[model samples]
Target chain A: MNFKLWVKPFENLAKKDRFTISILWVAMVLAYWLITTAGEKKFFPTPLQVWQGFAALYSEGLVVHIGSSLWLCLQATVISIVVSLVIAYSYPIPLLRPLSRAMSQLRYLPLTGITFYLTILVTNARTMQVWVLVIFMSLYFITSLLAVIKDIPQEEIDHARSLKCNRWEILWEVIVKGRFDYVIDVLRQNLAITWMMLVTVESILVAAGGLGVLIKNSDKFMNHGRIFALQIVILLVGLSIDYTLNTTRKSLFRYSKFN
Target chain B: MNIQYEEKDIILQVENLSISYGEKVIIRDVNFIERNVVRKEINQGQVVAVLGRSGRGKSTLFRALTGLVKPSSGKVLIPDYSQAPSNGMQPAKEVEEGDVGFVDQKYTLFRHKTIYDSLTFALRKSGEKGSEKKEKVMKYLIEWGLEKVKDQYPNELSGGQRQRVAIIEQLLSSGHYMVLDEPFSGLDIGNIQNARQSFKLIENGHDLNTIIFSTHDIELATELADSIYVMGYPRLDDGSLGTVGTIVRHFDLKALGIAWRTEFTQDHLELVKEIKSAMLAS
Candidate 1:
């Protein structure tokens, strides 16, 4: 009965999606338990050991590191979104088209290679890291948003104009409102990149105190349990954030439920 | 053909309207005639259908009427309501909100907004506020049998429902005139009939609203339009094909004793054949 109750929620999911998610979850947990317990070399710590490490870090005030990292990611993401919107919307204008096209090409440049130059350009390490992340995220964001904007139906713009909408009104009504779902989807897709760069930047700037710094400190002491715990924390945090964004998108664009 | 309505009763006029894209002319020298009078004007509350085959510039004519496509040489005239019209006609470009409403082939609706909100948003844009807007929306929702789907977003509705909503939104926003571009293309017979009924209800014998729609369906045009404008490519006097699309035939269905709600008898079918042949010949 309890199994039936628990499975009821998943009944609405597509059979294939349900199957995929169930198999992946079970396999991941099984592999984690088996590999940690059966290993003689103690290469991977047990789940209990990792849990103990998490508890210790939690009591030692790990929230500060998590909060700082989240704050920095939030700031960079907001800036990237604002800048990308401006570039994507204005790209149709002849004067701005070349600049937008040139900036979009920057996505092909590796973030790691650019970080070296960015560090030199900005004196402060933390500021440099943020700028590097902003640049990387903004380029990705601009390209995705431009593609979304391009896909907006011409009929929608014409419809708005027929309703006496001027250029600015058409921009707000058709371009912004029509592409809103895609915008949210783009943000969700690029968020993974933002988290990846956040870890890389924080780890490289060793003086910065963040989740990446915590992981680095654990690595220095050769504490596999703490390292695994911090890794798990980052994974969980990233997953939760992604889940929140998905929920937000679904809730805000409830009409998409039919689609 | 010469069709005339009183100057005060006419809502729209197209005067030697021609449209072209750079070196290519899409439509040229298109004109409509009043059945009796000398003035070539579409009377208020009259349904006008532009009939043509695909790519014969029916959609282009509609676009020019809506001012989306600028006319190459001539002008589309709508009555200017801002001032007492000196000539009873103003250029189509001068037509604003509350003057013309257009529904394209896609039946475009705001996917994010509910049917109720879509109506209210249009009203708000036209400067309506508060209880008046809500009252008007509710009244139309019930009148159109869309009350059940009032709170549902556009995507949740069926195609016919969405089309109805689009029509109602246009009617509420700009009631004076409407141009529907191929509104019956993908619809089933039942929905098409329902759409016709909706158009009839809006026109309502009051001669206040005017509608112009384009369709390739001869039967539909014969049934719905008070005056039918057949657009096609014509042979030019220079012994070469005319590049511009022009009105090849203009006639009033009522004047020919065709009733709007009459069954499709053999006579009606013959009329349809004649129109089809005329369309092809042009």
Candidate 2:
């Protein structure tokens, strides 16, 4: 790996917004230190204690919890994408439009409440919760897809037709080309939301080990420090996931107008 | 109205073609035979203008000609429809391969796509390969005065620039039968001239297609049309839009109006002038 490639973006960032950006960074660090230190005894251990906990957790099969949550989120997200594509393609047809719209509106209901309500119907609450997680997020994904498709200009369609492109070719070529920027934009904005949904579902529904389970179990004994430390881990994990997704989207959609 | 062709062959024959939206009929029983259509056949080398007032169905006529719209009652037959319509002229059904190029009225560039990508997409669809597509699309862009704005997105360009991009895109596609819907609307003189130049190049360079378009500008129509079809008039009692005043004037209005007294405004007054003068003097 060329360390220089990694350093170039920081160098440009420094030149562009050096003063305000550095000040903001320093402020954030100071704020984090104070919050973690002040709550060291009751809620969080000291910064040093948190570090030691991280070191200790690394050897104590913490990997299982991390891996499981990561796997579930990935699974849920993939399911969401497929479901979204189905909704997008189906909703445009006259017969399915009303049903798709109704389902999309229902997605706004509180996830926890829906999970609890659905639990009565299914024998296994965890499985139902996972499916519900996928379905709920998929509704949002479908809405975004619809917006992207609808926003494509009619001229592109006409141009495609004049060129003798079949209906399918028009969809794949002009319409897709026209609205690709919005699709990438929607994906970028929703990466964090997907992770948040994953953690929320895992925390409330999963019987097995996950970061959520650790936090919940720690909460039972009122071990506030461990709960706070678990949250830090979750935050870092969510950030890493978001960063990876954004970078990938930016690279893939480089030809898109937004770049 | 019956259309008689003396010598010119009818390229597009619209027999009693009428269009309606719900209950209101927009144009009814329109009839005409274009002159020199056989001898002056475009061979894909001519540009024709369809000029009319707003709401007169100029765009509708273009769509009807291209079979995008189903006429209420009539037939549109493209006589001598080219076997290999130029590339990028996909209609609902694959008739013969009569390609038609369309520049939509709206500024329909993909807002998120860079100029490079937009042109690339159009060129690739036209079966242009490798560096040829790039060279041709870029050549049109430069010729149409889009070199400075080549890297910009649709949103980044001005209205004229965006429209030129749309024009260049269609030009690169290189369809034989080109139909532009008010291509000069909202453009300044220079952009309009540039767009016209680009269109002229397409027609002259590719002599396998005929171009048809609609506009509200009489000047443009007069400048570009090989034969003008002026279509703003009410149907007479006989269920035909009477001859255009210019065409009627050409046919000796006095002789044609002898049978219909009420229709002859000047002749009726001329006959009654002697009696009216005596009454006025008394």
Candidate 3:
């Protein structure tokens, strides 16, 4: 392979070459970390120490904590997607335009501040956590979904109209059914935010005993190894979710995978 | 020699139409009428081509004709099916969106649906249901030579296949009039042949079907259209090109006795030269 091929901008490699480069880059990062942290395994704990920490976490029921986090994320994903789709799809309605636009802009607000009001409104800790995540994600989700609807080329809508579809049918055929691939794409993108907020929200309600609680407990003891280990777990789980969503999108709407 | 044909009552009419974006006039006073062209013992649809240079508002005129864009001054009228015909003439009504089939250059399709599903969805508003709907869609798919690829998604088909499917979709939904914007643009020689062949196939589908298309290729326009409209900026009293676009010249190939010929002739080349000269002056 031409080494220069790797640095060329926007270059697309064959699947085998692409996979080879990915593994090579990951190995380089591992090598760099192993070389740098050879002596002092103090502040930045070594991977071996982190592995031991991972083993310790497993003994302390890490699987259960992970299951809690995944469950919370899944619930928020489904609910937020439904609610966000409703708000975003309502953007074409003149009367509901303001409500949709307002919801889209709500993504900018700091997440923690809203939890206070939410706490007073909803008393149950678990329900409050779920609501907190749902609100946090729905805002970003709505913003993304609305943008997808807005960026739809006028040609597609015109094509739909030429097919004798009325206003409501146009909304259904063009906006909702046509671009559904992007919903899964947007979900994959916002799932990262969902996982990050999972830690933050779960930290608030310790009774939930999620990965966020484990993170909080690790922070209290200044256990850098355990925190690092939990971070890896979260990263892997997040990657898996992203992979699943991307697969679903590519399989269902085969056109979406087109370059 | 090609067989004789006669023009009947007006099928599509554009009267005193003008449209502007804010204060910038795009197309002004654009008027034309397409009558159903009936060949002796043969089904022949109307093929009206609009030829113009870039920025000449051909696209705007097409959008107006298709009722996708409302004109500022005048209206487009087509035969209204809601009412009965009188004295061999159909009643006319102002055209509205969904009244005309529009096939844009890209031939965009619903990304998620297969070709078969997309065509069925197009017929949903037609009120045809059960096996009848399936049979109708299947008939078009087979006639258009898209039966094998009917199960494929838009991404899986070639460009020409997608174009055929797009045209068939519009035909199934909106009965007759089809406005194709830049249909010949960017097509290779073979693909252009395919596109024209498909256009002829659709005409074979219905005698009342009309195709209004735009293209920059003057020679192709002369060969394909029985009636041609040349859209360009008009000359003002100051002897300068005006900003607004209009029909600077119209070519009735039928009157010239050069339409629907199997081969391009010297007369067609002469018309092409005339059109090019008109475009240059505009």
Candidate 4:
């Protein structure tokens, strides 16, 4: 009876998400054109010149810098995961809950300046950078896990006990199950924050060979094309990781909303 | 199903049991027993419901039995069986290990786990391994009408369905005496009926299965239990709950003092109209 009903499918194409997706597609196309159209040595270099620069870097045995940056991030992320897991599990013990919670809230304290100062005092650049990155990322990771644990309802705890489950069984089964989605959600959100922290860590003069260093060096030389290229590389990497993690989260909880 | 076995003479024997939470005593020297609790001499299944006004030590009795709350004074001796202490000073006695299943007043499904995971977690932890355990879990799930939601999260389930899941978890762990505390609380009529039917199937066997629960719903308790323990507020003397008097009652409709009341089909009420009438007649 309603013409709107017949046109609903087409009408949905104009909705916010679809429109946003379309806008993104157009923006990417325009960005590609703008960068390519800009002559070499201008405000933005051609995509080919940027690719050649990347190729040249790889050929010149500068790949070690990329590997170093990646290895550092990997170490930091793995350390953060282990440290946070231990903090989260330890929270159930009578004395640990409050202590862990207090430590986690301390994460809200500015990590950037803390990392900067700590790096200066430590005297060694590489070890200092790794430790600072790990410490800063671990705080947020552990806090997020604790928040998930606290969010679990008492009803769920009672249910596990009634089944004649011991303390560990109850924690593993009921408490963990009830709060895992939120825990995963927290992890996904923190991945971005971790990278930002890592960038800050890289920006320090103590450490060498990271994307942050490249960007900083380009800015100092007033090499706009190199700056743009580095920015693009960082954007692409961050976007890819964010997309993958988000998709994994959704797939893991397709039947229900985790958060 | 008739539970075919040699009934161990005294299934449960509680002698001078007392329970205190923090500084406050909840249950005190409550000497009670079901003489010939499980008797092959008489193969009859029994369900007991403990009903009382809000603060009358119903949950405390269950906790005391399982040793969750330690008894302040008296010793609880469950005949000739003792295992090492687990989670408390009292050893998980033979009677305590798999003998009692407690359905807490609060829903206790694991937050991050699905119904299937909750069930399997208990079995695996309790030294149940291999395909047989999985089969047993699957069997219980289907029997309990939870096959459809076996993979669903606890938060997604309705209160009654979650309760069923809890029951399934309990049963899968080979719990003999299912002690439910206010399981029917916060449920609608339809949910209550469904819960009743589910419970009915589980408690049908003669020897192995017995259900004991504390409930405020006097009518449902009366309908389900073979015997009922009803308590009133014990008078307080000098800041302590004194043992004054208990309005001891029993429910068997064929016997006098037990009759269904309320004219409305939809509305069920617990009134002592007939008991009072019988008293007046006497």
Candidate 3 DockQ category? medium
Candidate 3, residue A179: the lDDT equals 83
* DockQ for each numbered candidate: 0.50, 0.21, 0.78, 0.26
Per-residue alpha-carbon lDDT of candidate 3 for residues A131-199, written as tens digits (9 for 90 to 100): 899999999999998889999999988887777778898899889888888888999899888888877
Model 3 TM-score, 2 decimals? 0.95
Model 2, range B57-83, lDDT digits (tens) per residue? Answer: 667667666656677776666544434
The prediction achieving the highest DockQ against the true structure is 3
Task: Tell how far residue B221 is off in model 1, in angstroms.
Answer: 1.9
For A2-106, candidate 4 gives per-residue lDDT tens digits of: 435434665544356666667888999879777766755444566665667566545644446556666777788778778888788778988888878877988
DockQ of 2: 0.21
Return the TM-score for candidate 1, rounded to 2 decimals.
0.84
- The share of true interface contacts that also appear in candidate 1 amounts to 0.63
Q: Which candidate ranks first by TM-score, i.e. highest? A: 3
- Residue ranges of candidate 4 with Cα displaced over 4 Å: A1-71, A94-124, A154-183, A205-207, A214-240, A253-256, B1-18, B24-31, B35-43, B53-57, B74-99, B105-107, B111-121, B124-131, B148-158, B236-282
Identify the runs in model 2 with alpha carbons over 4 angstroms from their true place.
Answer: A1-64, A108-129, A175-184, A204-207, B1-7, B15-17, B23-44, B51-57, B73-75, B80-99, B106-175, B185-191, B206-208, B214-221, B227-282
Candidate 1 residue spans exceeding 4 A from truth: A1-21, A28-63, A92-97, A110-121, A218-229, A257-259, B1-10, B33-44, B85-98, B125-129, B236-244, B259-261
lDDT of 4 by residue, B198-235 (tens): 76776564554667787766667656665566654444
Query: Comparing 2 and 3 by TM-score, which wins?
Result: 3
Model 3 clash pairs are none
CA lDDT of each candidate? 0.78, 0.61, 0.88, 0.65
Model 4 steric clash total: 13
Per-residue lDDT of candidate 1, residues A76-123 (tens digit): 888888899889888767788888888888899987788878877899
